[model samples]
Every structure is written in C-alpha cells, then in structure tokens.
Target: MKKNQSIYLFVVLLSGIVFTACNKLIGIGAPKNQLVTESVFKDTISIEAAVLGMYSKLANYNPGTDVGTATSLFNGLSADEGYYFPGTFYDDFKNNALTPTLYYIDGYWSNLYNVVYTANSIMEGAGAAALPEGYKNRVMAEAKFVRAVCYFYLVNEYGEVPLVLTTSVSESNVQPRDNVGKVYDQIEKDLTEAQAMLPSDLRYYGGNRTRATTWAAGALLARVYLFRGKWSQAGAAASTVIGNPGLFSMQPDAAKVFLANSQEGIMQFVNAIPSSWMATNLGASAAAVTPNFVLSDSLYAAFETGDARKANWVGIKVYGGKNYPYPAKYRYINGVGAVEHAQLLRMAEQYLIRAEARTQLGQFTDAAADLDVVRKRAGLGNTTANDKPTLIAAIEHECRTEFFCEWGHRWLDLKRWPGIANPAVTRADEVLGKEKGTLWQSTDMLYPVPQPARNVNVNLTQNAGYTN
Candidate 1:
C-alpha cells in the first residue's frame, strides 16, 4: 500500500478477473470487485478511469519503480547529467555496475510490464464493451497511447523485449523477445492509430491535462521518429505538435515549465497524492532530511555564466562539508500548496526535436531559428551554429541542458545520437567520460534483461554482454 511501490502490489487477480482495491492510494478510479473483463469496459466512466490509473502507476517513483526516480535519478547518474553520492544502494548505477541480478533492475522491468498488462486488458475489452462510437474510439486510442509509450521505453532500455499486445495469459507467457526494429514498428503503428482517434481539441476528462490528447500523440511520435533517424517524419510530427499554437506554447519563463498545469505541458501526470518523488529527490524541500543526489561538476560547468537555466533551475547546497548542486526544477516536495504534476511531455522538447530534425534535413537556417526559441527562453542569444553540423551540435547541446533530469531523455539521446550520419553529430562517447580505467562499456548502452524475468520465462534472452 506504500506510495512508492507499483500498483501491481495491490492488484487482485482471479480467474482472468482483475481489479485494484488501492484506488484510494493513488486517487484513480477503482474497478468493481471481481468484475469480468467484458463488464468492466461496459461503461464510459470505467474505461476513462482505467487510462487514468496508468498515470497513477507512472507517478510512483519515490523509492522504486523505473518510471520515477529509476529513470530520473539513476539515468542522470549513469549519464553525464549528474552525480550521486557513491556507496549507497545507488552506487551500482553511478559506478556503472549494472548486471542482470542488480537489485532494482527487475522492479523497473515489472513496473513497465504491469502497465502494459493494464493497457492490454483495456484493449481486449474494447470490442465487447457497450459504449458510444466516439467514446469507444477514445478509450481504445488512449489505451494504445499508454501501451505504446511503455513499449517504447521497454525497447529503448532493454533493447529487444516480448511484445504482448493481448490479455491472454497463454499467449503472453511463452513469447520470446522481438527485435528492436519490430518493437519500434509496433510503437509506430499504435501511435499512428491513436493519433487518428485522439481528441484534437483536448477535451480531456474533468478538464485535466493529465489525460492523453492528440497533441500528446504527436509529441511522442516526433520523439520516436527522431530517435529512429526518420528525419522527414520526425520534422513533420514535431511540426504537427508545434503547429497547434493554441494548445501548445513554450513558457516564457524557464522556471514555470514544471509548475502544475503550466502552459508548456503537452502531456502531464497529475500527482493527486501529496508526495512528489521529483521534489523529494531534486529540490530544496528534502535536502535537509535526505539529500541523496547532486548535479555533477561537469553538468554544473556546462552552463554559461549568463544562462538563466543555471541560475533558476540548477541549485546548490552545502552538505557534509562539500558544495553540492541539486536539481531545483520541481521546487516543491510535499503536496501542500500548488501540487506538482509530473511532466511527461512538454513544448520545449518538441522544439528541440524539430531543430534536430531540420538540421538533419540540411535546413541549417531554419534549424537555427528553432534552436533560438529554446536558447532565448533561457535568457541567451541565438546559436552560433550556422552550418548544418554546428547547428546539429547546438541542438544536441540544447537538449542536454534543457532536459537534464526530467525523464531519461539524456540517456535515450546518448544511445540514439551515435548512429546519426552527420560527422558533426556529437558522439555520446565524446561526452560520457571514463574514470579510473573504467569507461562506459558497449553493453552499458543497453540495460541487462532482468534475471528474474528469464527465470520464469525461458524464452526470454538477456541482452548482449550480460549473463542469464
């Protein structure tokens, strides 16, 4: 019943009947007890609650769960974004000591799969459910959006993974890992279908930004295509999101982006619960009690003297006789006044994606304009990157500084950037430095498939360079 653990801990499953009694815990709609799969989706409200429940699961990042601190904290530690105090339980990540049997590895893997299960459960009931045409399409689209996002993270983190798109236990159990390309293909198909069904006007349930919309679909597609090196598709998808100026626009103040219901949020998870893991780990609220992480020396030094991001977003505190910089993006830990919503997607990233995509397409002049939108927002001048190569490098640098500890954007970018054909594209290795005869290994690029998963499912294979 703890807030930090996955909602799966409270999920009750009986004879293909699934429901959660911990609905009060995460403040999402609860399923009727022992409700059959077909009956559960009969009502429009129930279907909407199911999608909201996925967001509740995604927000549980206090101590465990990969979607929360696992990505925001550990990813920052593993990448060049920040530093974690060595010798804690997190040392394995900061020290680059990842292995199949690592303590929290399976927690992340299970967390994501549990979400996929919920999405699949919703999708399976779509046809049988009694609902209006528009309502049914919206429900199915939102389910696919959540499912596709989870699968995207799964493929990027674990490389290849089982693609379970159904609720049939017999089918899901014996499946082997699919190739990354196949996984990406499924993600594209799901997102594309979802985009068509999503509400273009953002008529989200309860007038909350937490629910997925057409803009969310577009932003996710842009990110997916940009990572896959599909330039035209990436640019067009980003433009689709950016083109909707009424629903989306950059917050003129960089500090306002993380605020709940800020203008910059394209898709966000409402923290109905009082506690915020992002605030607890990064901001000034929990520093005096349990300050576990701080920004790395290199990251703090990456910002220019006049950069407003460094002045406003990055913060410093003296802990244990050493000066440590902590992330002040959230600035609020407890849910008292002005609750913090977990920012899943925002306007800033779409701009960066477009900039990178445009640079890749040899539109250097246009790329510089997009890059400046972010730079000027940070109280800086236009980029010096005039040519394609320099423009691409500038865009990459903007992504690193603009999005440091939000999601695993930096980590994902590091893995994807190496494959860019542009010689000027800054390689991840050139940026990720080594320490004491140890550098990030080729295998380190992808996480090991959790050992516990392989233990039960013999078909599941670990990624290269990790033992089963």
Candidate 2:
C-alpha cells in the first residue's frame, strides 16, 4: 500500500488534516477580504485562477491524482460497490474501536477538508478581489459544492461533525458541532446554491473527471435529502437529474460494467488512460486479501441466468479450489495494477435513491417505476408482486445484487439504514446483508473520531460512545 506520505496531508477523518487533537482550528464563516487584498486580482480572468484553486483541492487529495498508488479506500468505504482493501489498517477500524484512528478513519477526511479549505480560500479571495460580477458568485458556488460534498461524506461516515465553513486560518473557524441534521441542512443549501451556479455546458474531452457539474450538484443534493429522510426534497432534486438524466445505464453485460473503459460511467476518478489499476488487498501485486472480490452468495443468486448484468458483472472463478464469484466489472481499478481514477457517484445510485425516496413518501407506484428502470437495465424482469412491500423488497434487492463490489456501500448502507424505516429495507422480511467479520456494522455506524485529534484540539469533542 502506498502510504499518504505526502507532506500536505496533516489531518484525518476529514481527509486532509492528519494531526491529532488540537487540530489546526482556523474557524468558519470567513469574510471575503481577509487574507486576500480586494485590489490585487481585479478582473474576471483572475477569478478563473481562484476556481482553479477549487479544482486543485480535488486533484490534490484523490489517489488517481497521486503519482503512483491508485488504491481506492474512499470509494470502497462508500459501500456496496467495493470489497476490503489490503495493506491499509487503522486500529479503530480493525478492532472496530468506538474511538478509532482519526487520521485513518479515512484519508477522505483529510482529503476532503484539504479541498474544502482550498475552496474556502479561493471563494473568499476571489470575492474580495471583486474581479468580475458573476465570477465570484460562481466561484463561491463551486466552493459551496465542495463544502456540501465534504459534509455529505462526513454525515455518511460519522453521524455528526463540526461545520467548519471557513478556512481554519480564519478567526471564526471555531464553530461548535452542528447536529447531523443541521450539517445536512447546510449541505442541502450549499448544493442548492451550487446547482444554480454550475453550468451544464462543460464536459471532459481528455482524462479529467472530478470537475463539478450541475448534475453532480443536483445528484448530491438528492442523495443528501434521501439520506436525511426528506422525501419530497429528495424527489425534487432527483427529478432534476432524472428529468434529463445523462446517458448512463448498465452495461447489458455486468462484466463490461467494471471494465476500465466503460461508457456508462457518469462520474469516475479520471486517470491517465489506456492504463488501469488494481491495488493489492494485502498490498501485494495479487489481491491476497481481496481474493477475487467474491460476490456474496445471496447477492449472486438474486440474478437470473439470463440477466445481462449477472453475465457481465460476475465471474465464477476457482481461487485455490474455492469457487468465488468475482466482480469483473471493476477491471479498470481492481486487478493487477493501479487504476488511478475511482468512479465516485454513478447514475445507478440515483435511481435507487429515487426508488427509495418514492417508497418513503408513499408513492409506491412511482417508486416501482424507478426501481423497474434500474432492474430493466440490469436485465431483471419486473417482479410479479405489485404490492408496496414486495416492490420495496425488489428495489432493495436490486440495490444489493446490482451494485455489489464497487466500493464498500453495502457496509455503510447498513450503518445508515439499520432499521426498517430506511427506504431500502421497507419489507418486514428483507434484511440487507452484513460484513463477514464485524458487529462494527451494527452497534456503531461510524468509527469513532481518533483519540489523537481530541487530545490536541480542546474544542473538538468525542462521539457518544467512544473511549477518548
């Protein structure tokens, strides 16, 4: 495993910072002209420079953005789509510590904040510069987009976190913890604002994949609202994208879906192409720990023999005499070498969110329609059971079976939705699967904030059940 040996990585959990306790507490709600003099950059052209800063943050933290390693822990932990990563270990993660390694909770923590800080700086700096009228607003919108994404990731990983909107270098950065609800609320607002500002005209011609777009902002808002149980908002946001949704769809073949050169991908980590990657499960050239990324038997059986998704998604191989169904769809980033880019938000998740949201809002028919769209793409015929309970079952089933082994959505999804109320688990009988080794998935949804971070940052507090 390539360690985050980069000097820039200083905190954890938030992705960019790696230091323990007494973290760099710069503060939030920064005014525009503090670090930046309003007169230096006085034109619209320079504003693009600031926006470039926003772009820089993503390029800085993403592994594909790295020089060598292309392992995808951030994507893996996102759930459902990925399997275990080797070589990397956090004490809290391994032992399921209520209070785990804050730094190692995930690099996304530091990586995200690093990006957020850069965004905040650019937004504030460019605004103060007053380069052009709409330029600052659009740039700030991009900052908000970055902020929303950071907070969204935080919410999914840990229930609640501090809402540090300003760069830590600012005096106001010392804001208290916002409840998970409020954090999400802010995320919604940020994305809403960003969606209005982002342009729909941009597209990547080369290997660039991380730039923000209206679809990304809109899709993220939908995901956040669905996560928070705001069904109507979720539906509205989802409709915006689904209304003119991208040409994304399942590869009639599941195996082709994970291939490096897949066409159906909506948003993926763009790597220098023609070459792909596969990080070692045990940090070896061969995936020792990942072990062919076997599909859960239950998930495999859910597909029919004729399902295009099944034939394309899973490969039945005997690794040392044990028959394992490996997810062949991720050949771009999962075998033999480093696939620099990791696909983050894909359109299929949107359909699940829409289907799940519709069910929560009691729009079963609409929900079933959304569910069927995904199912048909996966080559699964519509279910015979037309009832709400049965339809929900099928939807959740599709989510699990169709989306297995991309990253680690399965584990996190269980955390986010442990109870029946979660749209994914509408049926009384349906139970989403669990991790093979840990109850870490059950009692605690997130690994506790690392002990080191709390020791130094006096303002920072520990989670409810952790040992600080």
Candidate 3:
C-alpha cells in the first residue's frame, strides 16, 4: 500500500541514488504513472502513489539484499542468542569483533538513510508543489513520522550520521557524522514535528509497525529519554502514553499475539516467502539457525511450570536420551510461503516500562502492581516488593520472562544500568563462566561501525572501539 501520497509517487519515481537531488527528481520527467512535479499537486492519485512507495521501502529494505535489517536482527536477538548469534561458531559478541559481512548492519544503515531521502523528496515536493491541502498534510505527516523513525534508527545504530534534510542529492551529498548529541537533537525535532502532524489513530500509520503515530511517537520519545538518561522526561513521556485511557491495554492473551492476522502487533516486517529475501536452501537454512541458536540451558531452566509462554519454544522431540528445546518464534510459519509477521511491540512492553518508571520513582507498591499485571499474564504469580532490592529483582525477572523471545531486550536491559554488572556476572557464572556479558565500560556501547562502510566513506569515522 502507499505510505502516503508523495512518497509512493517518489518511490514510483526514484528507486535509488540516481535521483537523490531535487533537480534530478523533477528533472527526470514524470513516469507514465505519475504527474510531473510541476503539476502533481493537481493529481491526488499520483501523490498517493508516491507516499505508498515509502511504506513499501520498509517491507522492501532487506538484509538479504545487502540492505540493512540490523534493527530487525538486533531486536530479534534473544537472551540465549546473545551468546550464540554474533559469532562464526557461537561466541560471546563483546569479546570478539563483528565482521563486515554482517549485512544487516550495512543494510539497515543504508535503508534508514534511503528512507530519509524518500521522505525528504515527499516533504520537499509537497511543500514546493501545489497538492490538495488535505492530501498534502496527510502524506507529509506520514513522511515526517517515517523520517523521524529513520533518524531514531540511525542514532541508535551509529551515534551520528549526516543529517540530510533535502531531496536535493548532490556531490556535496557527502556528509560527515554529527556528534551523538546533535543527532539526538535532530531526532527530537523530527519526532516532535511528527507527533504534531500525524493522526491520533493507529490506522493512519498504515504499515505494520513501520508507521509512527502520536502514541508511538510518545513511546519512542520515552525510549530516547531513557537512553539519554533523562529520567523525569522519560517518565513524563511514558506516563502520558501509559495512562492514555482507552488507548492501550495488555493483550487479552499475550500468547496469541502472533496468530497470522494478529491484532496485538504494533509492527513487523514479515511477508510471504518466495516473495523476496527468503534465506536460501529453506530446510537447511532453518536447521542452521536451530543448531547454533536455542534457548540457553539457564533460561530454559528458568521457565516455571505452568508458564504458558514456555510453550512458544519448540522442545526437542527426542535426541538420544535427552530432550532439547528451541524457541519456535518463527516456527509456526508452517508453510514455506507462509508470511510470519514479525512482532515489534505490543501492550506487554508498556507495562514493563510503567513498572520500571514506578520502581525508579520509588513507588514500590505501585511498581509491584505494574509488574504483577504483566507477570499475571505470563502465567507467573503476582510479585510483592517487600524491599528495594526485592522490587528491582522482581522487575528484572518479570522483563526476562515477558520479553523472552521477541528480541534481546533482556541483554540490552543489562547493558543499560550500571553498578549491577559484577554481581550479574557472578549470577551467570554457572552458564557463562567468569566473563559474563557486561556493559562494564562506556566504550563497550554502540557497536563499532562495521569496517566495510568505514573503509569506503572517507567522511565517515569509526566509533571509538573499532578499526578498519
């Protein structure tokens, strides 16, 4: 479907960098499906086509195509795969370096910026042209939201990037990275604008989670604040959305949030296979993923009996005398062509954040209520926070279980907080030995901008830790 009017039109117009410049945009002359820039404002259909193309970009930005899906891949890492997913043969990611072949990183970075360009074309064209007022505003709002999201992804991945705001691509297009601080500033600018311009409802977002709206913007702002350590702002942003009546509530059954036509999903980039970007050699591809990746024995054993979430994983049918279990998150796709919609967010995370914010505010009892709401859904009994440490532990435990398979939220949670490291290392010593995955130092953050891109973009510099 069209992302918006102008973007879909531009997508129909521009496929890659050849037309990044605003001049080249209208310069190429309009395609048969489009109205030329000089006259598109009079044609709503052409405008509609351009906007739809922006949404299609998300569905089309594939890691397999050497476009970035790093966000997709990173968000998919589980507590178990943090140990296995990064290496040649299942090694801890921190102790080793990631290779340039990590196409997801490259692709995601490229795709996000491409989104920036597509979005800019829509924004600039509409602003400079004479599209219908209603159609122009709607399409521009969608474009801004997507552009805001692109910046968020970039800032999260590479602390800084060239902040290009025009559809005009030129030899001058080569831009150096902005400091992380400046990037965050640009992100806030876009999100604030996006929040104002986007509609209040979910339908306007259009694509899975690809679209951003008022609440999504709020939620993302909360996340940004949290990451930047703006606790009060984070609390305020999260609370606004968390307390928005009739807006969001936990899934009636979190277990069924993934059914083919599931309603609970905020967004996912899933599509029917053989459609495009299928990992080749299907069965063997499936097997390769399983052998190297499975629930860590520690996490597997962590599941309490009667926990319905445990059922999501595919337990080994039989292996010699032992039985093994692998997460079946993607398993039920069943058919080779079945499109398993990827889940990005649901009601579950908001509860965890409210619980966390409450805990951080020292409202232990309230925090406990927040935690219990989620804990109750996962088949875990309600938790009581008898003391400070107890409340924190309870919150951590709730998150581990709540976000188990969707993404490696657990690993990132550990990475965020400080002074909690060594003790956690001691805790994981049994499964991971002396070197637990620790965010012991600041330098450890923001993965090295992979070498391949570094070597080529002379204006680009690597993050502090990596070398070409």
Candidate 4:
C-alpha cells in the first residue's frame, strides 16, 4: 500500500489523534481552522477532496480499517469457522479470556469511530458548501451511507455503544451509550435517505468501483432489516436489487466472486495498492507456505462430498507432516498486480437475506426458490425443505457454507439465530457445546467495550461478561 500518500490525504479528516482514549482525556478536538474552512468549502474540488479522504481512510488496510482482517480473524477463532495458528494475538478470543484491554479489540473500537467522525464532518459541512446542487446531494448521501455502515458493525459487535452523530468535541467525548434499538433507528434513517439520493447505477471515480450507489445502499438495508427481524422490509429490499440485472447478478462460478470488478460485486473495497491481507493471512502461496489460519475440521466436514465450493475455495498443504487446509477464495496472496479487491457487500448475501425473510413471513415455497439460486450455483440440486421450519434450517446451512471465512458472517449468524427470546436453544449454545465442550453464555455474543473508551467516558459501561 502507498502508506505515505494515504496517510497524508486523510490526516486532515482525522482532525486529532484518532478518537483515542488519551485524546478524549486531553479534551482535544479538530480545531475550527482545520475543519472544512470557508475557503475549502467554497470550491467544489476541495469539497470532493475532503469526501474522498474518508474513502481513503477506509481503504487503508491498517490495524483496524479492514474489518475482514484482524477483526474477522479473531471472530472466526472465537466461533467454529476456523483455527488461528499464529501467536497469542488470537488467544484471548479463542480461549474466552477476552479483556477490555486487548489492543486489537481496542483498536477496532477507536478506528471505526474515527471513520464515523469523518462522516459526521462531511454531513455537518456539506450543506453549506458552494457546490452544484447534484454534486452536493451525492456527497451528503455517500457520507450518510458510510456512517450507517460503521454503526451497523459497531452495534452488532458491541450491543449498546455511543452514538456520535456530530463532530463537536464535547459531544464526541461525553456521549453515553445508546440502546441498541435506538442505534438501529438512526442507521435506518440514514440508509433510507441515502437510497433516495445516490445514483441508481454503479458509481466510478478514476475508473475504480469505490463509491456508493443506491443499489449498494439498498443491499445493505436488506441486511440490516434481516438482522432486526423486519421480514417484509428485508424481502422487499433484496427483491429490488435482484430485479436490477443491469447492476447485479449471481456469478455462475462461485470462485470468481472475489475477483476484482466481478459482476456480483454490489459494493467492494477497491484495492488501488497491493494489499490482499485476506490471501496472505489465510492461504498458502509462494510468498508464504504456512498460512496464519487453517480451516476447522467441523467446517471442512460440513461440505458435501462433491461440493464445488469445497474444491475451489480451499487449498490443502502438508506442514510438519500434518495436513493444513487454508482459505483460497482470495487467490492473490502476494498482492502483486492487485488482482483481488476486498469483497465487502455482494449479491449472494442478498439472496440469503431474502430467503430468510420470506421464510419468516410464511412464504415457504418462494423462500425455497431463493435458496435454490445459491444452492444450484454451488453444484447442488434444489433443496427438499418443504416446510417453513425445515426451510429455515436449510437457509441457515447455506449461509454457513456460502459466507464462511469471508467476513464474520458465520459468527454473526450464530448470534442472530434462536433470537433473543429463545436463549436456551441458541445456536452458539448448541454448537459450542459440541465443538469445545463448553456452554455458550449470553454475554459471549458481544465483545466487551474497550477499556480506553470507558476510561475517557465514565458513563460507558462494559458488556456483561468483562471487567473494565
């Protein structure tokens, strides 16, 4: 990655040392002059520069920027998705000794909110910028979409969190954790507005698929609704994106979905530089023979004997006279030529979301059809799940295989299933019991609020299980 260039571009957006615990204690905020100064807002080019700065911050594959990197690795180790062979970086997650002081966990919390701060800066400044009407509206919409996505991951990971919507110094440091339901309400509001303002087609800047569009916003809304149990809304959103064949389609080959500019990419993190951490850390390549993570026995055994995904998505190697299977979805481990881009939001997930939503709404037969789209693509025949109860189980199985090791999809699925009301039969409770011989506690679902955040703001309470 062009670390120096990216850091220089985003330094203005950062305003202060990242939203760090130390910074908050010192009462530091972006100085008024450093924010979108009147001179900067008066020019359209400068305004665009500021917004692109937020994109640069996200695309940087540093400690906390790439959610699919360290964050997903830790989550997969904690769940049944995979096994980490690296150092004690993963021990806290794997062995359930997670404390608030874990550096990576703390970095994830602060880095995400740093992105949130940039988004809020744009939202606060764009309204007064002297730009063309169309340009101003599009910039505002993109910022809102970015902010909503950040909060989506935060709420899912840390149940209740501080909802920082403004860029004010005092408000940023003093805000108390909002209820999870309340946080989702704000996410819904932002995405709904973004859907109307962004363009219907895929957006491009300098010939790269980095900007958000209305379709991207819709696909994400579908996922958010699915998580929140809004069945009809989720189904409708997914169906709308599915209908847009010009903008999206399922890649007939499951192996090609992670390739750059693939047809199935609804939204992706365009890699302008060579930094495919997914491949380097998870696969065996000439650049590195021993990968950091290996596929879990349970995950490998779950595949059907002739499943195409098993053949195409995993690579087997012998190290120290033991077989190690690693994720091969990302083929460019060396990151030379930047052949692979990070797959964040894609079309396949929309189908699974719709299938689950339709099942909840009692549209059993239609739900089966949506499941078949993904199933057939994976070299499997139509499912035989004829009833709602049976079909829900079938859909869950498809998600586990389709999205394993890509993001934290499997871990999040285990948390969302069985719903909050049915804690006794939670999927984690059952699966963890068999895999690790231990019972899953309810609080294990959420990561503890990082101690640094709590140290800065006394009102922030840690999640149920951990001590600050």
Give per-residue CA lDDT, model 2, range 352-437, as digits (tens).
88888888778888888888777777677775646667765676677777655444455455555535555554221124234334
The candidate with the higher lDDT, 2 or 3, is 3
Put down candidate 4 lDDT per residue, 126-200, tens digits, no spaces: 787777888889889999999898899889888998888877766666678899999999999999999999888
Best by lDDT: 4
lDDT of 3 at 229: 72
Model 4, clash count?
Answer: 0
Score every model by TM-score.
0.89, 0.75, 0.76, 0.91
Q: Mind giving the per-residue lDDT tens digits that candidate 3 earns over 278-389? A: 2220111344434323455666777778777776433443335665455555543335533555555556676667667766777778778877777777777877675667
In the range 1-468, model 1's lDDT, one tens digit per residue, is: 453243333231221244242211111122344336676676765665565565666555224453765677778877877665433667677766688887678777777776777777777776578789888888889889998888988898889888988655445656789998999999999999999999877655555677788889989999999989999999999998998959779999877777777888888877643126676665556436435577777777778768889887877777678777778777665554356677888999998999998988899888899999999999999888998768766877788889888788888887777534533543555456443126566577778887776766778887887766
Angstrom error of the Cα, residue 25, model 4: value is 10
Q: How well does model 1 score by local distance difference test?
A: 0.73
Q: What TM-score would you give candidate 3 relative to the actual structure?
A: 0.76
In order, how many clashes per candidate? 0, 56, 25, 0
Write the number of the candidate with greater TM-score, choosing between 1 and 2. Answer: 1
lDDT of 2 at 113: 55
